[model samples]
Target: MIARTKIKPVLYHVVAVLLGFVMIYPLLWMIMSSFKPSNEIFANAGTLLPKKFYPSNYTTGFRGFGGISFSTFFKNSFIISGLSTAGSVFSSACIAYGLSRLRFKGRKIWFVMMLLTMMLPFQIIMIPQYIIFNRAGWIGTILPLVVPAYFGGGFFIFLIMQFIYGIPKDLDEAAKIDGCSFYGIFGRVILPLIVPALITSAIFAFMWKWDDFLASLLYLNNPSNYTVSLALKMFSDPSTQSDWGAMFAMATLSILPILLIFIFCQKYLVEGISTEGLKG
Candidate 1:
């Protein structure tokens, strides 16, 4: 029995390690290929390690095209992601609070509508949204990408509502006894307690905004306004030899922010997700 037990754990760990490596292999290959020469990128496709470390890809990619630098693309991504994250987190929290705590007629109906919206894919609304933005003269600007985030995303609102549901109603009653208004209760009592959920929402919002390519492509026509995701697409040309090394280099760099955020805030994310359903 002792021998079987030890062997089972060893086998489980071996399988787990293999699965982990399989899942992460593509990312590892991309990072490694970025250090290779443009000519050798495909030539050594099977190899994970580069024959020679070519740092020129970083320089070439950073130069960018049409006289704009990669720095501009990075800055644009940061701006859109930061604003969208802030807007989504704040709006979602407020909406979640209302739906979870406030008693109103048709509240269940509104909540159901919000849940239904989550089932509708972005493609279903893309054309109508584009037409609306074009009419509003928001085309070729970041407005189309950033403005909708302020209205609260359905998924985020749902996530935060679950978190809010887990909170005891006694706190709200206590705040009310202290003469605090609903807004005051939200800002002072609930917001402070729901830090984990808020941070979890912000992380998802920022990562999604940062990696959004289709939205950026549709809204941003000017190269000056291009985000990192859209700018990366510019590296490929079907008519000419594409610079694979530089593309890979920039791609590697693009994921750093997301990786760092997850690494740092993973604890909060896990806590928020695990505990949100405990009461709800």
Candidate 2:
């Protein structure tokens, strides 16, 4: 029995390690290939290690196209992601608080509508949204990308509502007794307690906004306003020889912010998801 138990754990760990490596292999391959020469990338497709570490790919990719540098793309991505995330988190928190804590007629109906919006895919509304933005002269500006985030995303609101629901109503009642208004109670009492959920939402919002390609492509027609995702797409040319090495180099660089955020805030993310209803 003891021998079988030990063997079972060893087998489980081996399988887990193998599966993890298999899942991450593509990312690893891409990182390794970035160090290779453009011509040699496909020539040694099966090999993970480059024959020589060519750092020139990073330089070439950073130079960017049409006189616009990769630094500009990076700055634009940061601006959009930062503003959108801030708007999403703050607005979602307020909306979640009202939905979860307040008593009002038609509350359930409004909540249902919000939940239904989550079920609708972006493609269904894309054309309508584009037409509206075009009419407002916002198609070529970041306004189309950043403005809507201030209205609160359905998913973020839902996540925060669940978190808020876990808090005892007594807290609100106590605040009321202490002469606090609704807004004062929300800012002073509820917001401080919901830090985990807010951080969780912010992390997700930032990562999604950072990696958003289709939205960036749709709204940003000017090369100067292009984001990292858009800039990466410009690396490929079907009619000519594409610089695979530089593309891979920039692609590898693009994921660092997300990786670092997850690594640092994963504890809060896990806690926010798992401990919501358990809190009194």
Candidate 3:
């Protein structure tokens, strides 16, 4: 019986390792292809190792398509993602605090409306948003991508609300007794306690904004203002020869930032998600 138990755990771990490899095989294939010469990439698609390590893929890819360098794309992506993440985290926290603590007329209605927004698909509002931004003269600029983040997204607001609800009302009452105003209570009492959840929100916001290709494609008309996602897409053309090696190299580079962010914040991310569940 003990031998069977030991064998069962070993069998389970073996299965899990095999499943993990299967899931990650494509990513591994891409990384390997990034090191291969363009000609050998398709020929050796079934293998995970390149016959000859070609370092020039990174160099050629970084030079970028057209006259614009990838440095510009990286810079633009950083600016848009950083600003959007800041706006989303702060605004969501504020809106969530109000919904959780404040009592007013139509407050429940407003909360319900906020929840309803999450149910509405982005495709439904995409055209309307484009028309609104176009009329506002913001189409060619990063404003369309960055500005809406300050208004608080539904998922983020809900995530933060769940965290806020976990806090004790006595803390708010104590702050009130200490002569703290609404803003002061939020800033002093609740904000410090919700750090894990805030980090979770920031990580999510950064990843979403960084990987957003569709919005960047639609709003950004200038090649010089293209983001990493757009720049990578420019490497391929159906009618002509595509730089598969360079595209793969750039694609690998593009995921590094998000991977680093998740690695660093993974502890807080797990904490926030687990604790938030206790409230709702």
> Which candidate wins on lDDT?
2
For model 3, where is the 10-residue window of minimal lDDT?
Answer: 271-280
Scored by lDDT, model 1 comes in at 0.93
C-alpha lDDT of candidate 2 relative to the true structure = 0.93
Could you list the CA RMSD of all candidates, in the order they appear?
A: 1.4, 1.1, 1.6
Query: How would you encode candidate 1's per-residue C-alpha lDDT over 1-280 as one tens digit per residue?
Result: 9999999999999999999999999999999989999889888899999998998999999999999999999999999999999999999999999999989999999999999999998889999999999999999999999999999999899998888888888888999999999999999999988888999999999999999988998999999999999999899988998988899999999999999999999999997786563341
Question: Clash number for model 3?
Answer: 0
Candidate 3 at residue 257, lDDT?
A: 98
Residue 254 error, candidate 3, Å: 0.5
Q: Cα deviation in Å at residue 270, candidate 3?
A: 0.3
Model 2 per-residue lDDT tens digits across residues 85-122: 99999999999999998899999999999999899998
Which residue pairs collide, candidate 1? none
Q: CA lDDT, every prediction?
A: 0.93, 0.93, 0.92
Residue 155, candidate 1: C-alpha displacement in angstroms:
0.5
